[model samples]
Structures are given as C-alpha cells and as structure tokens.
Target chain A: MKFLAEYRDPELAKQYLQEIKNTVTQPWSIMEVCGGQTHSLVKNGIIDMLPKEVTMIHGPGCPVCVTPLHLIDKAIHLALQENVILCSFGDMLRVPGSSKNLLEAKAEGGDVRILYSPLEAVQIAEANPSKEVVFFAVGFETTAPANALSVINAYRKGLKNYSILASHVLVPPAIECVMEDVDSHIDGFLAAGHVCTIMGNFEYYPLVEKYKVPIVVTGFEPLDVLQGILMVVRQLEAHKAEVENQYARIVKEEGNLEAQKMIFEVFEITDRLWRGMEIIPMSGYQVKEKYADFDATKKFKIEIEEAEENPECIAGEIMKGIKKPIECPEFGKKCKPTNPLGAPMVSSEGACAAYFHYSGLVEEY
Target chain B: MASKTKPVKMQLQCPMPKLDFDVITLGHGSGGVLTNKLLDSGVFDLLSNEVLDERHDGAFIEMNGKLAFSTDSFLVSPIFFPGGNIGELAVNGTVNDLAMCGAIPKYLSLSFIIEEGLKMTEFWEILTSIKFACEKAGVQVVTGDTKVVEKGKGDKIFINTSGIGTIHPKANINKNNIKIGDKIIVSGNIASHGMAIMSVREGLEFDSEIISDTTNLNTTIINLIEQFGANIHLLTDPTRGGVATVLKEIAMATEIGIDIFQKYLPIETQVDSACELLGLDPLYVANEGLFISFVEASIADDYLKYLQSDANGANAKLIGSVVNEHPKQVIMESAIGGKRVVSMLPGEQLPRIC
Candidate 1:
C-alpha cells in the first residue's frame, strides 16, 4: 500500500492540480502516450479538474488498437484452421479481423486458446508434438521481452511445433511519426513510464530537441500523471523543451538491459500497419530472420494480406489525435464496441475504446 | 476479412494432465476447462447452501420490509490501477450490489486489512478515494476499522465493505420474470474496466489506452426503472465477472435458456484486442462500469429508447433474449453460422483483476 497508496492522495492530487493551474498561461495540448494513464485521467475526472488552457488528448499507446486487421484475421484463420492451436492473451479474441475475430472463430469450433503468457504456449508445444502451436504475439515494448524470451526458449529446446506471429510495435517511432506530420496537434508528450522501465527514457531526449516540446516519462499512477503534466506544462510555459522523469523509483534512464536484449534477439524493426493510422517506417517489429523458423507466419507459410482500414471507422484519425471516435457518423450506430468498425475501438490502447468505455455522458465532452 | 494462409498446426496435445496434483496450481485457478472441474468437485461442495449456493459474488439477504445487505472483498493486484484505487473500488463495489437488487444504496461500512509500515501518504489517498467514491454514489461511510499485518504477510491492502439500501416496492424485479422472446440489452461497451486493469497491472500496452469503467450505476438503474418500471425483468452489474457470467446466472434464475447474438454484444475495440492478447474470454473477464438488462419484448422498444436517451445508456445495444429451455444454460448465437454454449467463468481468468 505504501508504494501505491500515496499516488492516490486527494490532497496531493489537489496540490498538483493547483500547481498545474497556476503554471499554465496559454493553451497547450499534452498527449499521454500510455493508454492506462489516459484511463486514469478520464476516470478520476482529472481532465475536468485541470485548467481549460491545458488540453490532454489520448495518444496511440494502445497496442491492441493499433494492430492491423490482417493480423487479427491471421489469428482467427490460425485458430480456425484444422490441426492448428492458436494461443494469445485475452484481449485479442474480441478484436474484429477483416471477416471474423478469434472469439467468433472460437465459437465456431476453432482451436483458439487463451494463455496467461507467451511462455505457456511454448509449454503447450513441448507437451504436444503432433500439432503446430502458434502464439500470436502482441503488444508494445513492455510485453515484447516476454514474447521474445518465449521464442528464445522455444529455440533453445528446438521445439519444432512452436512459433509466433509477431506483432510488436515501438513507441519512439510512433512519437516521431506524429511530430513529423504537418497537421499534427500534439504539442508535448506524457511518455509511458512502464514501457520506459523496460526500454529506457533516453529515446525521448532526441525527440524533445527535434520537436521542441516537453517529454515527461512517468508512471501510470494519478500522482505520477499529474506531476508529469505539471513538469510538461512548466516546460511549455517557459518556452523550453526538456525530458523529465517522475517515475524515478522504478524507471531508470537506461532501462532494463536484459529485456532489451531478449527483444532484439527475437524481433527486428519493420513496416507494419496500425489500425487507425497509416504504416510508419520502422514502427513495428517482425520476428528476426534468424528466428524465422519459429515465426508462425513463416513456419506455416501463411499468406498475410494487408486490408484497408474500415471505411466507417475514423480510428486512425482518432489515434492520430486529428479526430474523435464520436466524429465518425457511425460511431454509436454502425460502429460500436460490439461491432467495432476499426482497430482503435477494438484495441485496449485505442483512443476510441477509452472514450467508449470510460467517458461519461457524451454530451458534456 | 482477409485470411492468413499459413502452415497452421494442431495445438500440442495437453500432455494428458494428471487427475491429481499436490495442491491447487495457478492453472487450476484459470478460467479454462480445469477451473470448471475444481468448481464442480471442491469449491462448491464446501460453500453450497440453500441460499449461499447461488454461486454469486455476493449473497443477497433481504431484510424484510426495507434493508438489503451485501458484502464484498477487494483482491486486485497492484492495489492501484489507472482509474480508481482500492478504496474507491471497495465503496462502489458494495454500492453497486445494492443497486442490482432494486435497492437505493445509501450507507456503507469500510474495513481495511493493511500491511504494516504502509505509507501514511498512500493510506490518506485511499481514504480520499473512499471519500470521493462516497460522494459520487451519494452514499455515506458511517464508520470503519483498520488492521495492519507484518510485511510480506499481505498484498499491501485488502478492503472489505458491507452496504445497505432501501428497495423500491413498486419496482419488483427478478430474473425469474424473464420469458421467451424477452429482449436483452447491454448498458454500454464491455471489457474496458477489466482489460484496463489487466494491461496496467501486466505492463501490456495497446495502440489505445484502457481506463477502468469504475462508476456508481444506482442513478442509471433508477433512470431505467423509472422509465421501464416492472418491464425490467432482470438487472445485473457484471463486475469481477463479465457479461457471460451474469447471463448464466440469469439463465439459472429464470429456469430458461438465453441466446445472445455475438454481433450485438457491445465491447470496445481495444478491450476486445486486450482480451485476445491475454488469452482471456472477454465474456468471462471482469467489468466495473457495465450492466445488462432483460425486459419483456413488448416493452423492449420503450426501454431501448429510454436507455439511449440517457448518457450512460448511449452505447446501449439490443443484444438478445431469453428462450424456452432449462434455465441452467446460456447459448449465444455466433457471428458465424453456429451456436455455442456460454457458461460461468468457473475460475478467475486474471487473478486480482477486479
């Protein structure tokens, strides 16, 4: 409780909110790059408590939301295919592929199974020698290491039946892509502290200098978020760009070397599609060439086709901070959480899902 | 949707799991096939009773003419998540239970089992969260007690909250009232609060963000009851367990089967993806800020309109309804051309995910 209780202190939250209120002199938009932080901001009514001049928009930190339709389609296809055992965490099952989702396939007698970790899939493969078992690896840097380590263990044991359809994404490339866009609205960033705990905070220093905006790497706690916001706002108010870290207790400047190594060994940066946004350079990671034999897409010789974003979904625009999920005419109509039109609504990190699940009356916002 | 043409392989055989193990493993606690077995053989045997055997998260004790009593314990890892903390969770969880039973949750008693040396700051924050939670739900924490344990003896803090409320007499509601052709409606998207809790706790990131759908729904329920009145056959807040669990409960309560259209099942894109990645069934995952209502088909339209007219029910969808069959089962029509049995979660998919 000591580690966590302090972060929720109302007096502390009020003190930080007051300081943030006093610091902001002009209108500024600061994007919290982690979906978890976004949830806290909305659920705690933090945004409403803040000064009107400081606008906080959600960012593309949701890994599931950014995953492409084809990847989902591939997972369902793998799950439904005879003799194939598809494995993934709970989140991917409801994500709509082009035609169906893992949940749908599961309903139709597909061999789709939920796992607590990628390593569990390896154990399943080890236990069964006859069937090909594929772990549909998903998420950002925080989970990449675990997925990577699973691959390493599979290779170490020479498990022929084990492989992964890697769909890992990076945060820095995404930030850069946003800043490079000419019509961008992101003025600063609340860097994901958990991701940085594994991948380090140094990456943002370069972005701060390049974009001339504040970048605060902070934990997901409310106090952490509020403090991070205050730091970023002060930087913006002073017309100065800097990189700050409020999650110093857990997040070091260098990050976890062991995790980075595992990730590097298993995956290599490559082109990949994001649900709501266009494909950016080196934003996603593919299974390393050396580990291709353990790659589900490769081992199965599966042909993956990139499908266009759902025409009805403005998820990409929403993810880019250019549009809101409600902006789409079909938001609550044709496109809903039950029948999501795009990835943003499906992925946990998506802005639209955040709005749909946690937002209060659509009218006040 | 494009399909992936790959060298799909069969799932490795389950290694013919042993029928006997020394003690319960985490796998047994998982909401898979094995977990169901444990419930059938072990857990239910000890706890089963005429009333307590209902297998609900919290038991409902009707206090004759006025009061409704319910108690719940908090056991979420990382005690603090994206939205509300344990203190907030403790208050709303008990309050929501009273609301579910057609009662206006009005007062709460808080008890805390804390680890020793717990930071004063953190404890203060928890109290603040409870204070705000009370304010939001329009409930009062009349009194409370706190106890501390040695370090490593506890998971930071565990909250036990008991609440009481007054039920509305004119608005009698029960799942048994559901009949064939009754319409099923969800208050909003599912899995947001559940997935958000998992992602933040597990350090999993998505293309979007996840926030806990933690809120007081007494007002929303009251709104529906006012508009639809007795037409609301059943009302349940699917927390700790998702929609699937509640549906199964209703099926048993009504002695009739249920069939929900998968397409009409409301959930966010990210929550869906998060469920998939975690190898969890969103139907079985926990939800903090969502509900499902079963109403007579004749009044379904009016209720639907009333739900949409309100902000909380803005994303409400007409999912499915009751069928003529034994009430012990739940059946969902797949988006694909097939029907599948949707049952109770049996075990916890994500431990301490509440």
Candidate 2:
C-alpha cells in the first residue's frame, strides 16, 4: 500500500502534469528508453496527462523484447542438446523465439529451468556436479550486478560446470543508437530510472550533448513519468539539452558504486545485436575472455546463423519510435502477442505489445 | 490524496523449516503440488459433495434439466485496486463460473467471513461495491450469512459466494464434446487481475498503474450461447491457475489434448510488466474477468466474431484447439513454433493471487 498510494498521489501527479504542460513549446517527440517506463506511460494515461504537442514514444528498453530470436534458439538448442540444464527467469520462459522458447525446450526433454536469480544456477551447478548448468543472463545494467555476482560466485566456488549465455544489453550505447537512428528523428529521452539507479546518470551526458537531446532519469511511478516528461520538454523548449534526474529519491547521480564495481569485474564491453536494430559498438556485456570458460555458447561451440527480423516486419521503424506497432502492416494481422512475428510483440514491455494489449483497435486521436 | 493503508507482510519472515510452516502458505494454496496434497489428505475429503467431489471450481448436474453450480471465496489482500475491489470480485467471480457452463446465472448466495476490528468506512465502501456489482451483473445475492472472527485470526474480510443457474436447453457445452477440431478461444488478455494485485503487493515502482479487469463475463457467455448453441463444446474461466491450468483441466477431463498457440494469446502491457518484476508467468497468474470457449472448428470463426462484437471480447483470440491425438496433455505452440507440454502446476507459483 505504501507503494501504491505514493504513485497514485493524485495531487502529486497533477502537480507534475502542470509542470510538464508549462514546458512544451511546439510539437516535439520524446522517447523513454526503458520498456518499464513505456508501460507506466500507457497504463497511467500519462500520455493523456501530457501536453498534446509533446508525443512520448516507446524505446527499445525491453531486454526480453530486444533479445534476438537466434539467441533464444541457441538457448533452446543448449537445453535440448542433452545433459544440460537451461535456467532463466519466468519472463524469458514464455517469450516466443524463432521456433521455440525455454518452455517448449523443457517440454522436449530439454533440461530447461526457471530460477529466481543467477545464484540459483550456481546452486544447481553445485548440486548437480555431473551435469552442466547454464544461465541465460538477459538484462540491462539494473540486473547486471546480480548476474555478475552469480558468475563471480561460481568462479569463487570453482564450479567448473556453471556457465552463462549472457545477452546483457547496455543503456548508453542504446541511447546512442537512438541518436544515430538514420531516420528515427527522436528529439529526447526519459531515461529508465532503475538502470540509472545502478549504473548512474553520468553515462547519459555525452548523448545529451552529442545528440542535443534532453535526457531525464525518471522513476517508474506515474508522477515520476509526468515530472520527467516536463523536464525533457523544458530542456527542449529552451534548446538547453542536458541530463537531469527527477527520481532522486532512489536514483543518485553517481549510482551504486559497489554494483558498478561488481559488474565491471566480470563483464567486458562488446558489440551486440538488438533484434531489429543494428549491432552497436560496445553496447552489450560479455563474460570477459578470462571468464570465457564459464560461457555457454563457447562451451557448446554453437555456430548458428545470426537471426534476421521478419522481412515483413517494420519493427526497426517501430523500435526507433518513428512508428507505432499498429503502424506496421504486420502488427495485428501477421504479427501479435499470440504469434509475435517480432521481439516487440514477445517482450512484456515491447511497444508492439503495449499498443496491442491496451488498445487493440488502435487509438484515433 | 494519497493515504497509507496498513502494510501487509507478504513474504514470510526468514525461511521457515523447508518441510514445516505454522499456517498454510502461498505454496499450499497455489494450485500446485501442495494444493493437490492438501486436497488429497483431508480438505477435499471433508468438504466435497457428490457434485463438488468433481474437484473443480465448478460442477454440472442434470437436475430437472441441466444445472451448473460454483462457489469461490475472495481473499484479495489489498481488497481494492484501480478498477474494482474484492466486493466486485466476489460478484463477478461467481457469475463468470455460472456463465462458463453456458448457464444463464440468476441467483447467488453471499457469505462474508469478516475479521473483527475492521474499519467501518472500509466495510461501507465494500458493501456499496457489492450492491453496484450485483446490479451490473444482473444477478441478485438472494441469500447471505455473516461471521466474525478475532482480529488477527482472519485476513480482513473474506467473502464467499455460490452461484446457480439453468443451462440453456439447446446448449450442450461439456468437455465430452471437446474434439480434435474444436478451437480454444480466450475472452481477453490473461493475468490482468493477478498483476493488478501483485503491482500493489510488491513495492516495485513502474511509471504506470495496474487496474483490475474484475468484471462479470455473463454477457459474453450469454452472447456465445445465443449464437453458437451446441457448437459450444465447453467454457470455463481460468481464474487462479491462469490459462495454463485451465487448458490442462479441460484436457484431462475430456481425455484429449489441447494446443495453445503462444503467439495468439492476449496479455496486457502493465500485467506483463508487473509479472516481469515479480518473476511470475502471466499465463500461470489469476484473472477474475476472462473465460475460455471451446467451440467446434466450423463455428469457431463465428464464435470469435461473436466474442469480438462485445467490449469484453474485443481482444479475444483463437489460440489452439482440442485434439484427440495427444491425450490428456496441454501443449502450447511457442511463438517460435516449438511445442511444450503445459502440465498442471507442480506447485503453487504464487499465493493469494486471486
């Protein structure tokens, strides 16, 4: 109730909405990079609460939604490859890949499992020494620290059987991707609050200056989102692009140093493929070459082809916030939650999924 | 204005003895292994009637004609959410069960298990909600009872409601009619009610609000019965066990197999987001406002259309269908086109989700 009551502070939400309204000039589009933020914007009618000229578009903030279909297949392939236990969070189990997810792999006699944390993978590795245990590590910086801890724990314990199929995407590179969107035309960003809470707000300054887009680190609360939008609009109206924090109650400018230290200890910056977006430089985390023995893909020697988005899908444009899920011809017809033709439909916070679930027929205004 | 409600400590303090617990835990009532064990040992043995012995949330009997009966107790922790409350939940839950049998639900018996020392204002708001919900559902709480317990002995107000309705004479909806060609149709997205509760239960922050889709589905049931008649093979609302268990039950009961297309299932953004935060599977979560229709393939299109015509069924989708090949198994066709057997829950995934 403490959680619910605070966000529902009608008075606070109204105050934020008032501030946001005072900031917008002419028409402008701001994209919130985190799927969690996108969900909040749609669920609370935050968009409706905002100034009409200020359009908030969803960004590629969802890890599950952004995970490439081939990676899912690779995880499934490992699970089914005999004598392997594939572990992942519950969210990744139901996500549809090119042909199967972990759930299906489990059904096909694959040793697929759902674990609460990467530490559980270590536990399973310790408990079952004869068998190999692999965790499908997928998340942004917010989850990286805990996942990094798991690998470090496994290493400390000297558990040779434990490894990870890391699909960790980075926030800073993703923002840069938005900035470099050849045709995306994104003007600003409401940065995901939780990620900043762990990784800090410092990384976003370069993007703010390089792309000339206002970046505001905002919490997931309704009031937080409204206040964040207001901050971005104010920066845009004054042509003063900069990084600000509206969720300071939890997110600090420097973030959790301990978490950053732990994450850096285990992971190295690497190029990663986002499902519909191009592979960005140093946009992902991979187990450092020294920790390569704990990597699943390397352990299994998988040589699968890099996956391609369904050619019929306009998800690339959708992911850029230049278009909505419904804007794609394939969205409801050939692509949807039931049979997601792309990552956006599969991830819980994917823009396509949000648009499909809340307003199935599409919003007119 | 934002006001603090009493905090509910959901996570039990420090892990108790793995095999031992003081009170029934979430796992015990989770509809998983513990639930099965709880039922096998004595709970079901003591409370079951010949009809109730069917061991389902619902039952059908051939009284004079055909009759469907169901009872559910609402123990929602928060009691109130964005769209509705436990009072509305109780009414809608009962009505939906009766409608699941293609029954024109007419009467309900309400029973309240109240915890003493509860606030009068909360009681007033809840009762008013009951009146509003009953009126909207077009059903009356014809009989009722009230019981009070010691303050800490109970969890606020627990409500139990039983419903009775006459099945349409022309309607022959039953698992027996579930054939290979029958299609599986869901009324709306899965997990709205479950996530609506979880969003509040866990102190997770999101830039959004989750509203309960806690409404009666009698109208949708009524429309389906009117349009499809005998083509309607079966109908049931996947409440506590989510869509996964619902399909498994139908598969086991009918001695057939069911395939749910993962790509075709419905899920809301907020519900999905909340589920992600809590490590919950939306399919395994609960819902008070959804129903699954098992209609013959020939009429599946029409039934989907009929469902689509209604506001509640606007997000309705034709998932998988019934099949005699894989007997007693519920398999979901993953979005990637892989198939997995969706077995009945091994244990409760979440407690008090309803």
Candidate 3:
C-alpha cells in the first residue's frame, strides 16, 4: 500500500486542487490519452471538482474498447472450434463482437477462459499438449512487451499448441488522430503514465511541438492526476508546449529498454483498425514473421469478414473528444452496462463506462 | 479510521482418524455400506447432538412461535482459503440468512454433492470446520444427504445448508419500515472475503496474505436486536455483490434514497490495495461476514458505540442514511467531495485489460 495510500491522501489532493484552481486562466479542453486516466478522473469525482475552466476529454486508450469487432469475432470463432481453448484478459470476455460476446460463446460451451497474462496461456498449452491454446492478446504498449514475450517464450519452449490472437494498439497514433480532427478542439493532453513507462515519453515531443499542446505524462492515482492537470493548466496559461513527466517515480525518459527491445523483436508495426475509428498507419503491432507460427489468426487460418458497427454508438466521436458520452442518444437507455451496445460500456477502462458508472448528478448535491 | 484486522485462526481440536480408504470412491455415495462407513468415520461423531443423533431421513422439531427457514448453496472453488473453507462458509451463509429475518437459528439440514476423487483428509478438515461453525452459531445439524458425481462433473465439493429459527420477540424488521432520516450502519470492514479468495485463486495470484472474513453474524444480530428492539428496521448481509448491490436493491425495492459517504465506509488497507491493483471497485466486490443494519436515526451514535465494542463488530460504522431525495437510487459521496450513483453490479467484477 506504500505507493497507493500516499497518492490517495485527501489533504495532498486538496493542495493540488487548489493549485490547479489558481493556475488556470481560461477554458481549455485537455484530453487524457488513456482510458485508465479517464476512469480515475470520473471514479474519484475529480471531473466535478476540477476548475470550470478545464474540461477533461476522454481518449481511445482502452485496448478492449478499441479492439476491432472482426478480431473479436475471430477469437470467438477460434474458441468455438472443437480442439481449441481460448484464453483472454477478463475485460475482453464481456465486450461484444458481432452478434455475441466471448462470455456468450462460453455459455454455449465454447472453451473460453479469462487469464491475467498471456504467459499463463503458454503454460496451459504445455499442460494440455493435445489441445490448441489461443490467447486473446489485446492491449496498449504497456502490455505489448508481455504479450510479445509470451510468443517468444512459446517459441523457445517449442510450444506448437500455443498461439496468440493479438490486437495491440499504440498511444501516439491515437493522440495524432485526436489532434488531426479539427472538430476535437483539444488544448493539451495528459499522456498515459503506464504506457509511457513502457514506450517512453519521447514519442510525445513531436506531437507537442506540432500541435502546440502540453503533454504531461500522468499516473492513474488521484494526486498524480490532479498534479498532472495542474501542470497542463500552468503550461496552457503560459502558452508553453512541452512534454513533462508528472509520474517520474515509475516512468523514465527512456522507459524500460528491455521491454521495448522484446516488443520490437517479436512484433512489427502494422495498419490496424480501431473499433469505431479509421485505420491509422503503423498504429498497431502484429506478430513478426519469426513468430508467425505463434499467431492464432495465422495458425488457424482465420479471415473474418469486417463487421458493421452499431450505428447508435458514437464511441468514435467520443474517443476523438468531439462528443461527450451523455451527448449520445442512447447514453444510458439503449446502451447500458448490462446490455452494452458498444465495447466502451463493457470494458472497465472504457470512457462510456467511466461516465455511466460515476456521472455525478450536479443538481442533486 | 479503518484498521486492518488479522485473520482469526481457529485451532481445530479433532484430527482425522485412520480410515480404510485414502480417497473417496463412487461407492462412498451409494447409500450402502460405503456411505455408512464414510459417515461413521467422522461426520457422525464430530457433529453429534441430540437432534442429529436421531439419524432420521428428515428432522421433526418442536417450534413454539413464528419460525424462519432459509437455505443457501456454496460452490466456491479453491474450497480451502487463508482463514476458512467452504464448510464454514456454508454454515455461516444459512445462519446469517436466518438472522437477517430477525430469527435465532436453531436446526440446520446439511447436504453435499461431492466429486468422486476427493481425498479423505480434505473432507475431514471440511467436516471439522463445519462442526466448529455449528457450535459457534449455536445450531445443530439434524439431517443431511450426500451424492457423488464423476471427477469432471463437479468441482471438489458443493454444500447446501437449510436452517430453521424462531423470530425474535421484539424484532419487526421489514423493508417497508425504512423511512426518511433512517441511519444505515455496517457491522464491520468490507471486501475482505473476496480479496482473500482472489489471493489464492489459480490464474491471478498476488503476493498478499489477505484472509476471508467468513464468520457467523447470528450472534451479533441477535444481540443487537435484544438491546435495540424495534429500533432496528432492517438487517442484510452484503454477500455476492458487496455493499453497493445490497443497498441499491433496498433503495429500488422500498423506493427510498440512500446516500453513503465513501470516507465512512470501513475497509482494511491490504484489501484496499489488492482491489486497486486489480482495477476492481470495492463497492462491487463480495463480502460474507459483514451486515448492514438500518436503524432509527436517534440511536445511531449509541448503536455504533455498542457495536464497536463487540468483537465481531469492532469496525462498525455509520456509513449513510435513508434520504427523501433521489428516490430509488443509492448515491455515494466520494472521499474527495463529489457524489455518484451506486448501481447494482451488472455482472462479475472482472480484472481490467490494461
């Protein structure tokens, strides 16, 4: 509890809130480039406590929410096969694919399991030598190294039964997508601290310079988020655009070099489709040729046709900061956590879920 | 301030005696020689009492007044955990259910659906815990049944317990009794049981020694009712869906508003950290030994003082109150200073895909 309790201290959070209140001069829309940050802001009631001048826009940083529907369908397809056992992170099991989610598939006797790590899937393959084990590998850069390492470890152990259905997204392209959208009207950004901890803050420099937007690497804790907001507000007040690290305790300038090395060695950048957004170039990772045998899609010869999105879901606009979750017609009516129409409502870190679960009734208080 | 309470380690007295078989086979559940031998080995002697010694197919007991009957089934994997096992959980579950109805639990009927290949030693340990739990709750197991399934058809063991109790004389607990300005009090820390199970679960193992808060709440509730009488309007244990689900269900059922303050909710430090690490909301987690009581506003302070002095309710807190505004909703004022709607848990709280 050492790192957790200190950051959640109310007195310290109050100091940061006061500092942010005094630092801001005008209205500014600053986006947090991680769904985890959005969740923290909404869950801790930070969005309501912040100065009125600052508006925190949610980003498309939830890997589960952004994983393409077709890829999900493919994973489910593999799970339904007679001799395959599909494993995935817990959140992905609830996200809807085309007609059914992985949980639904599981209830229908599909062999679906929720695991914390991909390496565990590798071990499962080792234990059940006869059955093929497919791990639904999905995440941002923070998880890429581990996912990549699983494939490497599988190959080293000569685990032919082990393969990964990966759908990894990156943070920088998402920032660019948001900034490129002229309607987004963003001012600054709170970069995801955990992602930066893996890939480093170096990627944000060019974007900061180009967009003239301050990008502060932020942690998920309440104090870290408040301090990150205050740092961004100070920069916007002074018209300074630079990348700063508010979570320096865990994230360094260069990041974990060995993790990055493992990621690059096993995965190469590729064009990947975001669930509700257009395909951004070099925005995702795919298993390299050397590890292609460990890729589930390739191993199973899967080619799922692109599926259509729910027209009522405005997740793309919400992720781009062009619209708030409440702006959607089905905000909490047709779209709910129980019967979510989009992945945002299902994934724990999703912006829509953060809003729905923690939206404060300003009038009641 | 919420303080971390170490797990209470029960010193089990009786050891497993030597049996002819090391592992239970299909014949053990056949209701013949093997079944009789199995029961005679320990279950008969360990839980022996006047009512259970009758050994009839069903129990016939005398009741003077109104009685409450409740039943529950336990299917928790990893039956053995840090502080307790499924046996105690089964006993406490039925006992608490009956207690919530303002009843003093008396007779319980236990049943088991066990896998064919369970070890005899493990079953004896579970039976010992069950014996200990029944003694602590002041209840007797009058009748029971056992069945066995093949290895793949069942998780090690599943237990179902049903209990009958007499309603307390002064208690008039009802959801309709909930009124505006009523105070809501929790009888201990929250989320410890769920985190304890999560710590030892197969796939997502973390390096924490958190223990389950699985204990009987009958004694605590009976004492509170005896002292406070009709002042206690409602008593509910937050079991499957933590504090939020239980409160939300009450709010929706009675069309009353509930506003709880996050700071006033008591939780252990290690459990809080584990929840944070797993990206889980403690509100949506599960609890076993904790109960939330709705009492009259005037006696809230005195009730909390009395509860805090009890060993089982040492971490009791006045978390919130029934409100007139926002009817049919449960709202929580966060520790920092904002309020949000606390909804029923949609499904199991899954770990985040970060």
What overall lDDT, based on C-alpha atoms, would model 3 receive against the true structure? Answer: 0.88
Assess each prediction's global lDDT (C-alpha) against the native. Answer: 0.74, 0.74, 0.88
User: What is the per-residue lDDT of model 1 for residues A1-365, given as tens digits with 9 covering 90 to 100?
Assistant: 34554676767888888899998888999888877787567545576678899988788888778777788888887888888888877667777888888878987878776666788788778877888889988888888999999999999999889999888888998888778877668888999998999989988888988889889898776788889999999989898888888889999889999999999988888987776687888888899889988988877756767666667777666666776666778765666566788766654455665565444222111
lDDT by residue (tens digit), candidate 3, B145-256: 9898888677889999999999999889999999999999998889999999887776677778788999998988989999999999999999998999899889988989
What docking class should model 3 receive?
A: acceptable
lDDT of 2 at A96: 71
Native contacts recovered, each model: 0.01, 0.00, 0.58
Predictions' DockQ, in order? 0.03, 0.04, 0.44
Per residue, candidate 2 scores C-alpha lDDT tens digits across B1-354 of: 011233432222122222322234345434588646534543333223455455445454444567888998999877766677788899899998888888888677777777765554455456667766777788766555556676566777899999888888767877777778888899898898777766554223234466778898887778778778898888888998888888877777778877777668888766766675574667889887888888889888888987898999999999888776777777665432334456544344522100
TM-score, cand. 3 vs. native? 0.95
**A266-316: candidate 3 lDDT, tens digit per residue:** 999998899988899889999999898998878888777778999989889
Quote the positional error of residue A221 for candidate 2 in Å: 1.1
Error of 3 at B313 (Å): 1.1
RMSD of 1: 18.0
